[model samples]
Target chain A: MNRLFLSAIFALSFFFMQPAAMAADIEINTPAISAIKNSMQARHNQLAPHYTSGAVGLTRDGLIAVRDAKAVPLKDRQSVNTLVAAENKDRNALYKEIAVANQNPQWESDIRNTFAQRWVEKAKAGWWYQTASGWVQK
Target chain B: MKQHLPATLLALSLASILSACVTINIYFPAAAAEKAADRLIDEVWQVKERTDTPEPAATESETK
Candidate 1:
């Protein structure tokens, strides 16, 4: 029947379309992704207060940086530096891990750009983030 | 004429299928990536409240 033939064609088209739709978004819950996410969440506590106090800020390249070394007291400056270093290390690893997990390590730059934009968008009103022009508070 | 009609339909369907495949390959997927990034950032930031209220801009010294 013509109806049956058309229906079969429709079904086949749908099957091929599904993956292309899903591939647009990054996968969030694979074991490797969840592991990296957990590490980042644990680090957030250490980073949060600094974000609030203007001691550290998000960089345009999707990493954390010490925005104002003087904002932190001299006594705690070394500690803040250490924290920033550790957080940036973890963030670099997280982006690399996500790209690797997706089986397209080439996506690393795209993934980083996505994160860079999201970090700026999701930043609290008082927190600082970098833009192509310069740093802005969001 | 009937045979030619079937061949035309088949060619049209094949063309549609090929176009769909090409779109999938060429799509930049900016919006999807943004959405994915937002989900992860929200979870890590534990965003609790919306901060859209009007406020004085932060001083240059504070953001330095």
Candidate 2:
């Protein structure tokens, strides 16, 4: 009887501890995250020139945008818009993937904010990024 | 009454353990999250020079 009681308690504790143990890891990655990162990296080359030209800027919400539509040539503007849209979609997926990978979908906003700060921090000089006041060059 | 004691004790302990689980508020691990973000950003941007400066330790903010 005593053995059975101890076994029951141990099993219950293990079951309850699983989520806490899983939640401790915020850097967990899945195949989905890797695929999203690869897609974004491949598109970065296409977006780099626009970032330098002040046409595309990093938003405060962890997204890219066409800050100056006129900076892009009229013919290329549509393509730039498409690129921005694609980048944003990938970025959104990246954040959600990270959160879901960690088994905490509710943490998506926190993950996004962390990435937003990181993007601005890593941005090169003369690159445009957003701040609370407005868009500024980094 | 004597035979019921073991079952009662088991139920009480189980209730406390289950309640503990319900109240467990896992906070956002900000430092770990920041590190993960940096890793992904570096890859996406293909950054070579990583002169990283640690930011202020983020408070244990509840994300739930």
Candidate 3:
């Protein structure tokens, strides 16, 4: 009887903990996350002008793309592409880093989705960002 | 056996009560995620603080 009761108690405890274990803390940070954010911040300076000129826009999937190449001078177009690619690489890393920091790498998509909306939400007044139908100026 | 009977019954009742309160949402907490994403965005973009946006609660721990 005592063994049965103990087993029952253990089972109940496990059941209660299972859900809590599955839920992730999205804001958790670590050294990897800090490094990724720092890199992104530094790159933002280079990307800021392109954002203003409408050469690039935040994508619906949390990445950046050259929305209007004509907005940039012909000489700077290649550099703009390089900047956009680098920014996207960092963005992807940031999402993965946050998920790994949370100890649940599977949360990467959700994290990226959250960032997609946030990047649009925090975009400056004159900036451009993507919508489901098409690109829209913010 | 009699003494153990009451304890067992009490434990069972408590377990059932807790089970009722258990809402297992296996999905990630979206609100917390949005707040986190906003925090990162503000840091990376170095945007000036907007009065219209509410400050993320610093005291709020991970939603469990």
RMSD of each: 6.0, 11.0, 10.3
Identify the superior model by lDDT, candidate 1 or candidate 2.
2
Q: TM per model?
A: 0.76, 0.72, 0.74
lDDT score of residue B16 within candidate 1 = 94
Report the alpha-carbon TM-score of model 2 versus the true structure. Answer: 0.72
Q: Give stretches of model 2 more than 4 Å off.
A: A1-21, B1-25, B49-64
The candidate 1 chain A region of ten consecutive residues with least summed lDDT is A19-28
Error of 1 at A115 (Å): 1.0
Greater lDDT among 2 and 3 belongs to 2
**lDDT (tens digit, per residue) of candidate 2 on A1-138:** 867876787788778877756654575467899999999999998998899889999999999899999999899999999999999999998899888888779999999999999999989888999999999998
* Candidate order, DockQ descending: 1, 3, 2
Using DockQ as the yardstick, the better of models 1 and 3 is 1
Interface RMSD of each: 2.9, 4.1, 3.7
* Residues A1-138 of candidate 3: C-alpha lDDT, one tens digit per residue: 777876788788677866554553465578888988999899997898788779899899999999999999999999999988888888888899888777668889988888899999988878899998998999
Off by over 4 Å in 1: A1-22, B26-28, B48-64
Best by lDDT: 2
Best by DockQ: 1
Clashing pairs in 1: A125-A138
Q: How well is candidate 3 docked (DockQ)?
A: 0.32
Per-residue lDDT tens digits for candidate 1, residues A45-94, read 77887888888999989999998888888999998898888878877887
